[model samples]
Target: MSLRSLFVDFNSYFASVEQHEDPSLRGRPVGVAPVAAETTSLIAASYEAKAFGVGTGTMVREARRRCPGIQIRVARPERYVVWHHRLMEAIDHAIPVGRVGSIDEVACELVGRQRRREVAEEIAQQVKNEVALAAPGGAIRCSIGIAPNDFLAKTASDMKKPDGLTVIELADLPHALHGLELRDLCGIGPSMEARLHEAGITTVAQLTAADKHRLRHAWGGIEGERMWGLLRGAWLPTAPTERGSIGHSHVLGPELRTPVGARAVLKKLLVKAAMRMRREEMLSGAMAVRIRFIGHDQRWERDLAFDPTDDSRELLRLLNGVLDSGNRRHPLPGPANATPLSVSVTLMRLVPRTQSSGSLFAPTQDTRRVDALVDRINNKFGYNKLYFGSMQLALEHDAAPMRIPFNRVPDTDSENEAGHDPLWLQSLNRFKAIAEGEHRRRERGGKGN
Candidate 1:
């Protein structure tokens, strides 16, 4: 077998982008959080912060304790999406990008002369150079991994640090991976590790050496057999799975922890999810809402099944009913004293929207016109230009910017255009101005008295 795939994984993606956009943050410990709250957890941490035992999922206060001088930045999803496109173009100059594994990872297929080890290494170097040149101030870096299959290529990419390149050849097979732990592989996590241990496959070597049948039995499915193939440098055919659901979750900031605020967030989430479902031409028959309270193990959840529909107003009504039921079953303490940490809305039991037929008792509201109008306005003016009145409270708050999932890229045509909406630009500028003004105010206040 030869080198067939090249994978590039961005290092400390969000933090690196922050540093790239701002020169002063280049070497400082930076932590990116979804919200500007001390209690929120870091979604990404810089290398400088990592040295002090800070990482994703570490609370902001703990990160500050670990690295006293750490700078915390609220995440800007739009900025990350912009950088993703730039990096992809940079890599495309070296080799046609075969697949975008996620926002922070891309893979290219090596063919013909490119498959040669020397040529592959040269292309990898070119990619690194291009990425540095494309990024603002040359602050972004990536780790490149060349292997016979995408899975192992991704695995090799994680073996090193910023701006590192590693190759896993067929000759290196099972023994070369013997020193690595079970979790070193992409799909193996803590739970998977425990299962592997139960199956007498505690090490990478043991996992690679196990029979496909035994592995399948251990996994209770065919995924183990696929893993067995991937471990041995086999390039398996890709199979696409239908999307099962559309959902969104938001981690509430300190100020928006009340029951009313949580409901507002849930409303916004449902609207977003419904919009996406309509865009994808999918209809959902069931909906569920979940709420997690701060510092509490118990969670509140409720689910309801209804006639399949993609109408946002109808879905909102159903979702509100679910929330009301949940409140009655597990009443929230007063908004003043109790805090809900997060809320999620999920739309499940989906089918093609085209398959949905009109119901005899459908509400009299002109949902189709309302939805079409909302989509048109958002498409022209940017997201959240026209939203439900119920979501007014959470409108100013970040609707928890959507993150691109590992398997897909978001629709970026309008967002990536040169002449994107001026309204969105104005909003961004206003936010920046307010932040800068606050910083200056703090500095002047410190200097006084």
Candidate 2:
């Protein structure tokens, strides 16, 4: 009926976190990349770097050419995760957080008196103030938006950034969003934009005015109808669907460009995926392996459907079999001549471990125990500390660091060895203290009432 949702989006999340962590990095242009390699692309750029036309997907060389003094830092995913939790705690001080849209965005639901525009704006401001306090030197800032639904709220948050607050009232309707391009809306990427154009919906106004039937036809699915409802300020359900698959992909470094190196990387990836699947208590019914060759259009993929499994050894065996069969059909380029660009492994048709029945092909109980023991040892010591000998070639390479996925947050267990700061632990403690203080204050206020 009123402003039912509030969305908060961090501006240049990774770069901001780096600047916040190091006071010297503040006010300077910074870019975060997966690796320190000159050929790597920046995953995020600070606003100052953005002034020089540097941005995500800009190669490090190009970014340096644009901003001669640009600073490039390797991504610290664990630091980002720590800050995410802290920011969520800060927002929770104002209102209960609803859904975490990503590492840098969160949505909160407003109910009762909180739904009033005045109250909603007050909560937004409080959230901003808390976030500033929680961040180091008050360096982090967020844009907040309040609207009738989560979709519009997210769009409004993006309208203005770097300490912005916007409210999209229902009374404003389609006119309020007319100034934005169709791509400004979430889910409207280049391909979707082309489809919208083919359907005679080239503008936000056209999209807003599109009939549900026409939208469904344009999208070729129910998603179009859902978009139509969202455009009209109707709230849509946010329930998650069952996960379809779990996979990991890696862009090979120069050292891993050979077939032997690529296979080693693939083995590492499958082991990681298998560990994750075991953690989730999920079994995979099928598996797929893909390899992309450098300087050629020859992409090789192999898929195999077998009894459900989460054992790393069994999955690796199956993956090796797939690779063997693929090589027999189409021999890989010579070890010295070929250059592999990337490799990926996907575990498909997942089912709950509890729902899976014993299969003749499944590993024996002793094998399962061995796998569990390895997982425990790795978890206790460090990742890859007890990996299979087949992955020895990739031993020096770091395990692909945990990254936030679209539907869920990844749990990372990073050890604080020499030279590494305990910032994550400190941040966690601060969050807990703030939460406890808030709880006590609420209790006292309740008694007073």
In terms of TM-score, the best-performing candidate is 2
- Output the worst ten-in-a-row residue range by lDDT, candidate 1: 417-426
Summing lDDT over every window of 10 consecutive residues in candidate 2, give the lowest-scoring window.
416-425
For each candidate, the alpha-carbon lDDT, in order, equals 0.77, 0.78
Let me know the TM-score candidate 2 reaches against the reference structure. 0.88
Give the backbone clash total of model 1. Answer: 0
Which tens-of-lDDT digit does each residue in 114-171 have in candidate 1? Answer: 9999999999999998987898575689999999999989988988987789999999
TM-score against truth, every candidate: 0.87, 0.88
Candidate 2 residue lDDT tens string, 1-449: 56899999999888999999999999999998766667556778899999999987776787899999999998787778778888889899989989887777888998999989999999999998899789857568899989999999999999997789999988988899999999899889778999989999999988888899999999999999999988878878587878878776666665666677788888987887787778778999999887765444456677899999888888998888887764464334323355666677889999998998947878999999998898888778977788788787765665343434445554555322210122322222222233233334544567679
Model 2, residue 224: C-alpha shift (Å): 0.8
